[model samples]
Target chain A: MKILILGAGGMIGRKLTAALLRKGDLSGQAIQSMTLADVVKTDAPASAIPLHTVAADLSAPGVAAELIAERPDVVFHLAAIVSGEAEADFEKGYRINLDGTRELFEAVRRVHGADGYRPRVVFTSSVAVFGQPLPPVVPETQVLAPLSSYGTQKAIGELLLADYSRRGFMDGIGIRLPTIVIRPGQPNKAASGFFSGILREPLAGLPATLPVGDDVRHWFASPRRAVEFVLRAAEVDTSGLGVRRTLDMPGLSATVGEAIEALRRAAGDEAVALIRREPDPAVQRIIESWPEAFDPQRARALGFEADASFDEIIRRHLEDEAPATTVRS
Target chain B: MKILILGAGGMIGRKLTAALLRKGDLSGQAIQSMTLADVVKTDAPASAIPLHTVAADLSAPGVAAELIAERPDVVFHLAAIVSGEAEADFEKGYRINLDGTRELFEAVRRVHGADGYRPRVVFTSSVAVFGQPLPPVVPETQVLAPLSSYGTQKAIGELLLADYSRRGFMDGIGIRLPTIVIRPGQPNKAASGFFSGILREPLAGLPATLPVGDDVRHWFASPRRAVEFVLRAAEVDTSGLGVRRTLDMPGLSATVGEAIEALRRAAGDEAVALIRREPDPAVQRIIESWPEAFDPQRARALGFEADASFDEIIRRHLEDEAPATTVRS
Candidate 1:
């Protein structure tokens, strides 16, 4: 199977690439080649299969067409500006997230129209698609009333994916991924960054701030689980999806208190002590509008799994990021 | 008030233009000037107000900027290729419906950024934005799962309108109009044409084909009521809309049987007898996927109204189209 991964330099994208390399096959077919495209040229990972890395701006004319010319069997589209960056710069958000996605779809469509070359296009949507006035457990039927430009762009991408799939231009599946808990990286300034930072920083023996209250909750999954969701989407039977091509992936819903408790279980009370309560009302208000839980019946029925609990999420992060610390735990 | 009508040549656009001209005011402001733009030069209506007609394709570069250069106080954007045509011609549909709408919004945003020139943009969406497995009475929170390309384009437009409004670029209101019954024109090839044909052709003393079973239900409003909804949207207080700027306009829910029965009441058995039952499965399949009814509580609370019954729909058609025959009735 030939695979193409957009945004291949990002954390999840790099993880997904590594997972594919380790498996050596997808959907019962041997891996033959792979193409990794991003805004910057991705580092070439040691691989037996033929690999090509390209720096490309997808929104630029001919970039998508050039990438699609190789005719990969599966296309993993994960490129996007984060919510904070998108909200800060409106034009850049719509340009890259909206227009760039459309251009990729159009490129595939043109190829499909020519020779019936329909590849499975797995798109990464977000939980940001659901906004305020949400139910305790959001159903698959909940209306997409995104409160941010980033969410709107993703919602639009989902719509286009469904339409293109229905028109026989491509086989498309969109997975609305939950926020990745214990994201393997340095701390950033995202409003939801603290969701990961509080756990990630504590595990690394560094202090992290808790901006929201202990009772404040949000949906989450491990970075490893997210890669699994992407792999499942690539090979799953899409016949049942009908015209509604997007699915809300299964995720663990937990409060900040639950997460902190889990952190203590993994790395002891010392690690938990690293969490500092310094409430920032701006971040708290932003997090309040986010979805806390979801009744994602479709994704569950499709056999996509989530981290068993917040403890599992923390355990997996340690095993993946810090093996020496994992031995100590 | 200076007003701009994007689809001035189309049915609802012409009606809206005429209504604005007849009223001589909008939002209690005296009429000053009007611009009518379409693919073909809209025939200049006899008006005491300054009227300018331009043949313009909205999707074309520089066209939207030129249109927004004057910055009309209200913009009634009703231009779109109908569902059937959009379904047949994919590129044309997205080009005109989706890209055109975005270009117009971009034009408005640029102006708003420069001088805070935010206009009240009344965008005409459709119930086609909703599709099958629908609730008996779809509520305001129904997920937008459109079944056709035209519906997809309109849904995308709605998303852009909401996002743009939230950013303070424009004060936009999108109204999802129901299938217009007793449409005053020769029968066209639209799947929903039968909804109007059974009543329109018969009322004009001509035989009309009824392609679906009498029990097949759908949502509807008269063209007159559709015009009223636009007018209301233009002047209504949008503060209550929050970021969800679109409303499903109130419409009467009736079956083909109910419409035929109403025809009998309006123009006597002679008009009802002119209807022919030539069931076309293709048309039936298309109509079956459409929404049957909507609760539309948001539009109701906003004072947007629908025709009381199918009888009233026919009565209005006669009153507006054939005034001389209305006296006979």
Candidate 2:
């Protein structure tokens, strides 16, 4: 089976591509070809399977059509500007996140319109779609009340996906991923990045500053689990989706204090001590506006899973990065 | 008080202007100016208020700025293409509904940026913004999952309004109006128009056809009530409206049979007999997709009232149109 991954240069995108490359079988279909595309040229893995890299700006009118000409059986779309950048530059955010996604959907529709080519589309949406006046644990039934332009754009994308899928242009699944913890890389412009950075940097023996109070709880999942959700979503029988469109993915709920405790247990006390407590009210206000937890019953029923505990999450991160190490707290 | 009414040619727009003009007391503020705009120049009421008519399409760039430059204290933005038209022409729908609203909001923000000139922006949203997987009665808390482009565009407008208002750029309120039953005009492209046409045409001594089944239920408010809702929204204290931006206006819920019975009670069995029953399954599917009723508790508490029953609604329409009616069959 051939698969195409957009935004393959990003952290989750890169990990997802690697996981797909490593997998010998996906839903009983032997993995054959993989194509990766982003604004920057994506690096190919040293694998026996054929891999194609395409660097193209999807916001350009005809780029979507050109990309869809390949006609892969599955399309993983993860391209979007970070929340901070999106909020700062409204025009660019809509241009890329909204219009770009629309163009891509149109490309697939046009291809299907020509000779009935329908591909499974897995769109990585975000929890940003849900904003203030939120219940403690948001359900799939919660209405999208996005305060930020990024969230609004993502919500709009979900609408497009639902309409397109209903019209038989393509089978689509929108996965509203929780904030990914232990994100393995330099921090991006996303305001939520600090949530991961506080834990990740401290574990790496670097001083990391916590922007909010220790009591600020948030919903999160490991990067590995997030990629798994996307892949499983692509393979699952979507007939049960039944016009609801997006599904909130299963995740773990933890406060900054809990995360620190996990870090102390998994990495050493020294690593935990590296975390500096610095509360910025501006960041705290933004963090406070976010949903503290989610009731992903539908996603769980559909077989999406997350880390059993914060320790397991941190352990997985260490194991993935430094496989030879056996650190004792 | 100067008033700028976008979509001045529309049903509620014409009625609202007439109502305002008829009111002798406007809180000691006389109607000094009226700027009317639509795709076509509206034939406004004959009043001493200096009237300026513009046939300028709001979708065109720079038009919103021009409209805002008129400096109307009260801006009634009711401009939009209907659902059927929006669904048919996706680009035009977004252009007018989404981009046009954004441009207008930005224009207000720009004007307010230099010297805080906040005008009261009253946007007319619709129940089309709510789609299927709805509860028996949708509450204020229910998530907006619009199945149509028109719905998505309107929801986007609501988001924009809330953000702009929260930022103190402009004072705005979005009222999700129920389907205006017994709309005093010819049938338009709206799928829900048949609800009004079946009653209005019959009352006017013309043959009216029912497109859907008697079992189909929908929310209803008279055009008079709709105007009142808009006016109330404009002058009402909006400090109570928190981040959950839009409010679903209170309305009566009735089936086709119920509506016909009310029509018969108001305009005699002769008018009721003018109704022809013809089931269009295509239209039925569309009607079925809509929510049967809404629990507009928030709107009720905010002082918006509705017809007691379909009977009251029909009576109101008859009283407004044919006041001297003496026979009840």
Error of 2 at A85 (Å): 1.8
Please list, in the order the candidates appear, how each scores on TM-score for chain B only: 0.98, 0.94
| Local accuracy of candidate 2 as per-residue lDDT tens digits, A286-319 | 9999998898887888899977878888877877
In angstroms, how far off is B279's CA in candidate 2?
Answer: 5.2
Best-fitting candidate, measured by lDDT? Answer: 1
lDDT for model 2:
0.84
What TM-score number comes out for model 2?
0.90
After the best TM-score superposition of candidate 1, give how far the Cα of residue B141 lies from its true spot, in angstroms. Answer: 0.8
Worst 10 residues of 1 chain B by lDDT: B320-329
Q: Which residue ranges in model 2 land beyond 4 Å of their true spot?
A: A24-33, A187-191, A211-214, B24-29, B106-118, B167-169, B187-190, B205-216, B269-285, B326-329
